[model samples]
Target: MKKLQFLSSLGFFLFGFLLFSNLKAQNSTSSSLYFPPLGEETWEKMPVNQTGWNQGKLGEFLAWMENTNTRALLILKDGKIVVEEYRGNRLTGLGPMNEGSIWYWASAGKTLTATLMGMAEEEKLLKRKDRTEKYLGKGWTSMSPKQEKAIRLIHHLTMTTGLNDQGVDLDDTDPSSLTFLAKPGTRWSYHNASYTLLKNVLESASGQSFETYFKEKIGDPIGMGGFWQRTGKNHVFYSNARSMARFGLLLLAQGQWDGNQIVTSDYIREMTSSSQGLNPSYGFLTWLNGKSSFKLPAIQREFEGPIVPSAPKDMYQAMGRNGQFLMVIPSENLVIVRMGAHSDTSLIPYRLIRDMWDRFAPVIE
Candidate 1:
């Protein structure tokens, strides 16, 4: 908690202020404002009583996971439920959480987009090696003439898309931004804009909207029935806690369902494991905890920005605003999902993922 309070003290404004500054000038320039839709769904509250999942000190911490809003946590290890819990104002502090409770995926949905991309590859719809210009020609052209050249889908997937945060870095055309932070296969950055654009490329190549394609390829198979937010909505999906777990199970099982393979296990490994080495803390669109190619020194800078050493070293997560998270730890054979408003004050779901991992790790082994 000392470390967390310290992290809370870090400069979150620099990240927010920097991001907000760029949003204005780029507003008209963007294709749409629907990137992450905020439409409210009448949340379906399940009975909060979970038999196997009431963890120890972790339970008290989990009660905080949903601190002021709806929340649920599920743990599966060695194919058994270790912990499951949900608390929301809707529950009125009674009843128990069940298998059905829809929660927003937020940016965590980006992993689904990338998963669809891998499935498309298996079907040969598009190739990662294809130049970004080939599929997103008109849009990529409009992005910038400089960005049009030599940018590949693989580069976009790994977040080395020759672009920088328009909000933080005023100069998108700056020399360093123009150049890949590291070569295509060497680095990683959390580029929301670039990853969202991949949605278009997939649609263009597959003749299917992003959500429909995912349902056809993945949801139906895993029995998750997860539904996507409309086009331009980058990270909004609704599904039960079990649905979230199924997605995690698909990943935990390395992209298979019902003894049938949906995505190539080889590709799943690439997506979950480090695809690029620049930031050892990040995977394709997911977050990870691991060694870095170079010391990022977040603690040295006392940085609490997105990339830092506050999470599990072996953990990879699909995280979003308002405390929506799906954390998968392969070594523990674990899948943990936490969804809710952790705090109105904290923006990154810092405590949900960061603190939960620390508490969960000890009991896991």
Candidate 2:
């Protein structure tokens, strides 16, 4: 009887030890990612040979970027910089573009706004299902009160507000510029006006100016040196290339920076995953690569297959009007940022992403 009792105790101890070991392993793996210090120019880097990438193809890949008008390109592996390069003129009389030069994110800033919305939701300051009129008040849009009531805050995030997008400048946010089209959530259009109104929604819900809230909640904490600029009627975000990479790293880490959960992981999952069925390739203001079909800006029909065929199925992007791209691939533990002048006239530039991956895959894979 004594022997049996001793054996049982030993068994329990062994089981507990194994469990503890497993948990520790997981924590170590998750914590392996490095984050650059806040308010500093220093960032850790991983050696190219250690990344196991084909070094021979790297030069050609970078040459492709320069030839394609890429001003800045950064690639991070496990939160460590693998490759960082800046080329081309600044065009702002600020000399040649470099690591410290500022560039417009254009529509890529939509992802930043979406993350802010998620943070606000986690704090109970706002809910995705809340009506836009709740924050913007009545008569904010030209639609009738009853019609506008059907449009929820989620509709704006998903770009399904059914606002009229038939014009040269779909980003105009004025009440007169916003006119009713189809019923809310019944159509999927990349209407910028609906997205731009989200700024007001965030402001009204948070009881703080958009700039102040963003800086406090995201920018300062992550060491992002950027600011929102008012260009005509639109509010655009501008930041240096490394600042953009830092945001991508935050996304790659599932909204966590170092040990702090800046934005809840739950909301990050929802924001990156497919939000609506009409366009499976679009998340909440973010573009997804792997989906059955995708819809483009100003286009009525859906295109078959993934938006970027060469990109990993799990990869999602924060793309802008010009060649700006913030791509996050969780499976590969990679975050790539590209900021440049217009590579093409297309709004989302799905083809540009696809072609870039075509040149990049040989080097990385």
What CA root-mean-square deviation does each model show from the true structure?
16.5, 5.1
Model 1 residue 3 distance off true place after TM-score fit, in angstroms: 59
Tens-digit lDDT string for candidate 2 (15-67): 99998996575346448789999878999999999999999888788877777
Instruction: Say which candidate scores most in TM-score.
Output: 2
lDDT: worst 10-residue window of model 1? 29-38
**lDDT for position 113 in model 2:** 99
TM-score of each: 0.70, 0.92
Candidate 1 vs. true structure, TM-score: 0.70
lDDT of 2 at 308: 84
